[model samples]
Target: MLRPEIARSWWRSEMSGLSPEAPNLRVEPDAVDRRSRLAAAAEPVLAELAEQLGDDGFCVLFTDRESRIVDMPIGAGQLRDRLEGLGVVAGGVFLEETTGTNSIATAHELRRGVAVHGEEHYLEPFKRFSCYGHPIIHPVTRRLVGVLDITCDTGNDSPLLAPLIARAARDIEERLLQSTRRAEQRMLAAFQAAAAGRSRPVLVLGEGVVLANPSAVELLDPVDHIRLRELAVGIVHRGIGSPPPHTVRSVELASGREVSVRFQAVAPGAEGVLFEFDKPDGTGATARIVGSARRPGVRTTEPVPGMPVYVGGEPGTGRTRTVQSLVDGGRTRIVTLEASEVAVHGETAWLADLESTADDQPALLVVEDVQLLPDTCAVRLRRLIERPGLWIALTGAPLAELTGQGAALAAACPAHIDLPTLRERTEELPELVRAMLDSLGAGDRLRFTPAALAALAGHPWPGNLSELNAVVRAVAGHRSVGDITPWDLPEGYRISPRRRSMTPLERAEHDAIAAALRECGGNKLHAAKRLGISRTTLYNRMRTLQITT
Candidate 1:
C-alpha cells in the first residue's frame, strides 16, 4: 500500500515536475519566519497548519501582485539565510523565467499548483528547499489576487505534503466563494428593506426590475419600474431601427457620480436579464409613482368579508388605492408583492411573484397583474390555495387570450367583482369628482360647473379612475374657484360625440368576461360567480364572444 506521504510526494513529482531525489529533511528557521508574518489576518489558518504539519515541517508564504514575497511564517536559521540568498526575500519578486526552480513562480504563471524539490531550483542556494504553492483568488470577484505557498528543506520533503497543501488551498477557495455569496445576499436584503414602505420608481426589464431603489427612482423621471424597463427596451429597439448618431444609452448614478450604463446579455436560459448601471451620486432624489387617468366608468373599491375578493379593471382604475384601503381598514394585512421583482430563496422555498409568501398566518397576498405571474408561480399558488389561512388577490388589464393558464385561474377563485368604468357609470361623475376634490382639500369651494362635469363624464376615460383624479386635481390647482367649465379640462380629456357608438351585446359580453377575469384574480370560477352564471355558461359566453380560453 502507498503511504499517504509517499503518494502525495509522487503525485507532486509527477504533476509539478519536482524530482523524487530531493533531500528529505526539515528546516525550522524558514517555517517560524513564515508563521510570524502570517500571524495577523491569517494567524488561525497558519496555526492550524502548524499543528497538523509539525514544527519545521511546513511554512506559509504570501505573495503580492508581482509575485513578490510579501509575508511568510518561517523561522530564522541557517537554511533561511540560504533561502534568502536564493532571492526569496520580502521584496524579491518571482516569475517563471526569473525563478526557474521556485513553485511560487511556476504556480503564479500557470494559474495552478506547483512543487519544486531539491536540485530543481535554478539557483544553487534554493536547491536546499522544496516549495509547494497555489494561486489565491479574490473571495467576491473570483479574480486571481495573490498566492499562498508552503516551503520546507529538501531533507524534510515528504510525498504527502503536496496533497496537504493542495487540500488547504481548495478549502480556502471554497470559503472565499461562500463569503462572496453571503455578502451579495446581505446587500440585496438591505436594498429590499430600504425599498419597503416607500414608493420608489421602478423599471422592470424582463424578469426583474433594473432600477427599483429609491435613489434610482428619484433621479429618473416618474415612471413605473415596469414602464422604465419597457422604455429601456424601446430605446434599444429604436436604436436598432434608426441607428441614431448618439446611441441610445442608459445612465446610472453611482457613488455620487453619473455614469453611462452597460449591459451584457446573460444566457438565454438565465432567470433574468442582467443590467449594470453607471455609478451615481451618493445623494438620491425622492421617488414617486407616476399614474395615468382612469378609463370611463371604472369603479374602485376595497374587498369586504365572506371570501377573499379581487377587483379588476383597466389601468389607473384605482386598484392600488382599493388594496391600500383594505390594508388601512384592518380588513387584511396586505403584502403587495410585485411579480417583476426577483427574489432568491433556497431552492425548496423559491417562488415566483404570485407564489411568494409561505406564511400560514392570516394575511392577504396581493399580486399585481395576475397575467404576468410566471407559470411556476401560478402552479405554486394553486397548491397554496388548497390550504387555508391566507387570501390571494390580484389585478390585471384585459388579456387578449385566456387559454391553459387563463382557464386554470378562472377555476380557482370563488368571488370576483368588476369595477364599472367612468363612461359606463357617468351618473356617478359628480360624486366621484366631488370626492376627489375634497380629498385634494379643494372641497366644494373648488367646484366644477355642470358643463365641465358633463364634459369630463362624456370623455372615454382610457385611464379610468386615475385619469379622473388627475383631471380634478389639475383643475383645482389651475382653475379659479366657481369658474370651472368644460374648457377647463385638459385637451386629452375632451369628449367627441362622433366617437360615441353603442357596442354590440357580444362585444359587451366579451368586455364583461375580460373584466370579470381580471376582478376574479384570473380565476374562471370566481369570474362566473361575479357574472351570476355557471362555469359552463361563462365558458359558452366566452366562446360566443370569440374570447380564447
Candidate 2:
C-alpha cells in the first residue's frame, strides 16, 4: 500500500503538470540568497556533516525557502556528477511542480520530514537513489528557513539516514536562535547607551521590537507609537553603510502636538534607529527642519499702470494664478491670449486678435507662454503696452532665461514677480497639502499623518505644485477616510530622500517589497502572495529590509 503522504505528494505533482517520465531541472539564478541568515547558520553545521559523511558516495543538498538548492556540501565523485546531470546541483530549483515527488520538494511541500526510496520516486530518473529530507525551522519565528537532505545509492539505505538529517536540521535551527538572540542583545545594549543620559523622549526601533525611555512612553499616545515605529523602520531600510546621521523630521503626534524627531542609527549592524524628540523652535515651524539654510522666498514688484507686468516661474509654480490675483476682485475685465496657439491659428490672426482685444475696451490682457511668440509679435506687444486704457501681463519662464522676443517683452514690463520652485519652498508643504485636500473635498474625510507630510517635505518636488496635486488626487481616489501614512504613498515617494549606501540587489528588493505592500494596502499576507513568496519568507525579508507594518 502506498503511504498516504506519498500518495498526496504524487497527486499534487500531477496537478502541477509535471510528467512522471522526466524531471524539470531549470534553475532560477536570483532565487538563491547566499547571505541569508539560514545559509549563514547552516554553513558550519553542513561542513561538519560533510566531514562525517566523507568518502561515502553520499550527497547532501541544502535549499533556501524558495526550494532552490544553495549548497551541495558533500557531493563526492560520481554522486556529484549524477546530481548535476539530473538538475539537482547548486542553484537548481526543486519545487514539486518542477521536479515531481522527491524528498527535497516533498518535504518542502508538506513542511515535514519525508523519505523516498527507489521505485517510490515520482520521476524515473530518481529510481536509483534513496533520500531523506528534514525542514530547518527558525526557533523564534517558526518560519521554514530551508530543508536538509541526504541521498545515497539504492539498497544502501540505513535507518539512520532519517534521524541524521533530522538532527542536522535541529542543529541549524539552534544556530538561527542563537543568531537572533545575539542581534537582539546588541540592539538593546545600544539602545541603553543612547537613552541612558537623554532626558528628552528617546526610543529605538528594530524588527518586531521597540524600546523606549519613560519620556517617550509618556509623550506619545498609542497611535503615535505605531507611526513612529513605521517611520524608524523606513529609515533603517533606506539608510546605507551606517545609520544616517543628523536626520530629523517634524511630525504631529496623535495628540495634536507637533515635535521634531532627530533620527540616528544606534550602531552599525544593530538594525535599530534612535528617535530623539524635541519641541519645535519658538516660531513653531515644522517643515524643512532637516537642513540649516535660509528659507526660499517669492519676490514681487508692485504692478505699475500703463506698463505691462510679467509673471515668471516653472510650468507648475502657480504663475497664472499669481497673475490673476493682481486684478481687483470680480470687477476688472480680463482678456487672455495664448502665444503658443499662434502656430496653429497663424501669427496674423493671433496678432490681429491681440490688437482687437486691446482696442475693444479698457481691460487687463494676459499673454501666456509668451516665449513662443515671434519677434514681429513682440513689436506689436510693445506697441500694445503703450495703449492708455489697456493693461497687459506676460507669463512664461524667468526673466534671465528668456531670449529674443520673449526677453524683449519681459524686459518691457515695468514690474515683475518671480515664483520659487517647490523644493525651495518645502516649508509650506503642510499648508499646501491641507489646502489641496480641501480642494479635492477630502479634507473632512481624510488627512495625512505627520510622518506622511514629513516624507513629502523631503522630496525635491521637481514638478512643483502640479506633481503634488496629481499625487494627492491619486491617493484620494483609493482612500476616503482616516489618516494616510507613509505606507499609503506610492512606492517612489516611500523611499528616504536622503542619500545613503545600499547594494543594487538590496535596493531592488526593498523597492519590490515596499511596492507590494502599498498595492495590498499594508496587508502582509496579500503582499506575500503578490510577491510570490511565502508569508514566512516575506516576514524574514521584511525584517532583513528593515520594513515594518
Candidate 3:
C-alpha cells in the first residue's frame, strides 16, 4: 500500500520498460552552462544547505531543467564516489526515462515536491536510498528551471528531508526574482545619472526596459528608438569592458532625418547600453550604421559598372536582400521576379514576366531562387542578363552546386557573393537578436540576459536565420517587458545537443534506437531486436551517429 503519487510513478516506470531488477544507472558526461541565471541563483543556496546537512550522511543535489546534476554540494567523499559510480555526480543525467522512478525525476515529472523511500523505489538499485525532491520554477516566467533534491541512505533518512528540499527550492526562486529586480534597479540608476540634465536626447536600453529623456522622446519616434537600439546592440556585442570611448554613428530615422548618435555602455556590470543623439554638423564625415547591413560575417557584393551580380547562400541567408542593398536605391531600383513561379504559372508565363519587367524599366532586374528555374527558362534568361544597359542579379544556391542552364545563368554574372550560414556567424548572435527584435517592433521593450544569449549561441541553428527569427518572434509575443532568461526560451531551443544535429528522419530513427536501448537497459542485442535491426547494423549506426549508450 504505497502513496498515490508513488504508485503512479511506478506505473510510468513500468510503462517506460524500466526493469525493477536492474536499473539503467549509466549517465553521459554533459557540459552544463555555468553562467546560467538558474545556476547562479542556486549555487549559493545549495552551499548553505550543504553546511547545515554536514557530513551527517545527507547530501544536496542541484539539477538543471534536463535533470543533469549541476552540483552536489553536501555529499561526503565516500557517498559521492558511490553515486558517481552510478552516474549521479555533477553533469550526469538522472531523468526518469533513464534512471527509473526516484525523487529528482518524479518531482520534475509531477511538477511538485516528492519523497521516495526504501522498497517504494521503482528500481531495486534505488531501494536502499531515500530522497526528497522539489522542482524550482522561475518566479517570473513560471517555467521549471531545475530541481533540488536531498538524498541519504534509508537508515539515515530524516523526517526533515521534505521540508528542507522545499525551502531550498523556494529560496532559489526568490533569488531569481531578486536578481531581476536588482538588474532593473541598476539600469534605472544608470539611466537617471545619464539623463539628469537632458541637454541632448538620452536613452538607456536594457532587457524589457527602456528609458528616454524628454528631449529624447521629443526628437525620436518608435522607429528611431529601434535604430538607436540596433546601434547600441552592435557596439555592445563588439565587446564592452571598461566603458570605452563614445563612438559616433550616423543613422537615418523613420521620419527621414539623419542624426549622429553617441553610444557607450550604461555602467560596468549593468545590463543596458546608453545613447545620446545630436544632429550631425554638415562638415563632419559620418559613418552610417544600417542595422544588419553593417553586421559582420555577411558578405556584400559591390555593384560593377555593367556586369551582372550573383548572390548565393542557403535559404533565409538574406540572398535577395543582399543584392537589393547593392543597387543605387535599394528595392525601389530593382524589379523582382521569383524563378520558383515557373512551376505554378508555367515556364512561358514566367519567362514573359521576366522579359517584360527587364524591358519595361531601367531598374535592376532581380531573379530570386533561380535554382528552381526550368532549364529552358534559365537559358532564355541568360540572354536577357547579358543584354547591354540591363543590369541583372540572381539569388539562389551557390554557383558550384547549380546544374545545366542555371549554372550558365550564374556564370554570366561576373560578381559573386557567398553568405555564411547562421551557425558560422554565432559571434553576431547578440547583435542579430537585437536587430531582429527591432524589426519585430519589440526592440525597445525587450532584451536578452547574457546567460540567455549564451544559451542561444550554443545551439547549431540548423534552420538558419528563418528558424531563429521564428523562435525570437514566438518568445517576443509572450513577454511584453523584462529581461528574457534561458528558461523563457522554447524547450527545443534550450536543449544542448550531445552530438551533431540530425535531419528529421535521422532524428526520428535516432530517438527510436535510443528508446529501445534505454528500455533494454543498454543491452545492444536486445535493443537491436526491438528496433528490428541486426546488432551489427545497430553498432555501425551508433558509431556513425555518435550515439553513446
- Measured over all alpha carbons after superposition, the RMSD of each candidate to the real structure, in angstroms, is 26.6, 12.3, 10.2
Model 3: per-residue lDDT, tens digit, 3-51? 8888988876665546688655435454564656677898899888877
Runs of candidate 1 with Cα error greater than 4 angstroms are: 1-306, 324-328, 342-356, 360-362, 398-401, 496-549
Candidate 3 contains a number of clashing pairs equal to 1
**Candidate 2 C-alpha lDDT tens digits along 416-455:** 8888777666546666777899999999999876557766
Q: Residue 543 deviation, candidate 2, in Å?
A: 22
Specify the poorest-scoring 10-residue window by lDDT in model 3: 285-294
lDDT of 1 by residue, 255-358 (tens): 12334444322222211222334435444422221121232333333245434555566677666775554553666666776554423443234463244364
Candidate 1 TM-score over all chains jointly: 0.34
Error of 3 at 475 (Å): 4.9
TM-score of 2: 0.47
Q: Where's the lowest-lDDT run of ten residues in candidate 2?
A: 287-296
Runs in model 3 with CA error above 4 Å?
1-98, 108-112, 117-120, 128-130, 134-161, 164-295, 440-442, 471-482, 487-549
* Better by TM-score, candidate 3 or 2: 3
Question: What C-alpha lDDT values do all the predictions have?
Answer: 0.54, 0.76, 0.74
